[model samples]
Target: MSNQIIVTTGIYDAIKETLRRKKVSIHEEKRLATELRNARQVLRRDLPADIVTVERKVTLKDHTLDFEHEYIFVSSTREKLKKNKYSILSDIALAVVGYKVGDIIDWPFKGGNRKIEILKVEAWEE
Candidate 1:
């Protein structure tokens, strides 16, 4: 998936607010800032139901590592990685927006690149 993503307007304000409130390091802040500005905001109802968006439960598999993880894309206020919730401000942008079920993500991980395939997209909730 491309770095540029689409964010539903319903969650835009919440994400923006969360981004402003989070006390992230410079590197993380920069990544979030770039992704934030690059996002194209649209109405929640107009957004494709199949696409990954805030509050959606996503099941992804790292093909290279042969590992899978399920995460709920949520605003910072609701983030709890221990509970599988992921914050949009943390640059899990691909897992949160634009991409749809069965889409493969070629995002870079710690040292090398990893391909992640979206297996499922449960409906989003507030």
Candidate 2:
């Protein structure tokens, strides 16, 4: 993944609030801080359709395990215990958000760093 990331203003504001109101791991805090610094905030309509953001459905492939996962990235308040919904504060979401389909990154999963590929991005529907 590139050093720079693009995010909608809403998601950007949510992230900033999350950082202030919630306690996260030091690594996550730093990672998010860096992302905020390098982020290019834009209006939702101005964002590209392929980019991943909160409320979007994303399909990801784990290169090392050869596994596929699907998730709907949601804001913290909107997150649920459902299997397919992931909070933006989650490690996977944090690593993938602001990125677009086809981007790959090495993320620190529960086991260790895994090579993950963003396969698809779908807009959310209410």
Candidate 3:
């Protein structure tokens, strides 16, 4: 895979700011940095519908676990509730955001490295 990813300008800035304000593992930090390094930034209006972004319901297939799960990628903790919501700062959300459908990524989590595949993405609302 190429070392390039596509992300909206807003999402990119939010990720950088959130990372600066939070304390995360060095491995995650490095992964995020690498993911954003060659990012093709686009305006919100130009962001592809298939791309994962904040407030979007994303379906991820965990190759290591052999299961699939859906999550609403939220930009703030306030958006999270009992539902299947994932904060942008969380390892899973951070790893999947900015990626498009069919894209598979290996992310370093607390447990170990996991291969996550982007299966679907859809807009969501409160």
Q: Which candidate gets the maximum TM-score versus the true structure?
A: 3
Candidate 2 at 62: error in angstroms? 1.8
TM-score of 2: 0.84
- How close to the true structure is residue 90 of candidate 3, measured as C-alpha lDDT? 76
Model 1: which ten-residue window has the lowest total lDDT?
A: 88-97
Q: lDDT tens digits, residues 62-97, model 1?
A: 888899888788776788878778875555643346
After superposition, the stretches of candidate 3 with alpha carbons farther than 4 Å from their true spots are 1-3
lDDT of 2 by residue, 10-125 (tens): 88887788778765566667778888999999998898988988879999999989999998988777787575788887778887889888899876555666898999999986
lDDT of 3 by residue, 7-77 (tens): 88887888787668765677887878778887999988888888888888999999999999999888775
Say what the RMSD of model 2 is: 2.1
How accurate locally is residue 125 in candidate 3, as Cα lDDT from 0 to 100? Answer: 85
For each candidate, C-alpha RMSD in Å? 3.8, 2.1, 1.6
**In terms of TM-score, which candidate is stronger, 1 or 3?**
3
lDDT winner between 1 and 2, please give it. Answer: 2
Off by over 4 Å in 1: 1-4, 9-40, 93-96
lDDT accuracy of residue 8 in candidate 2: 86
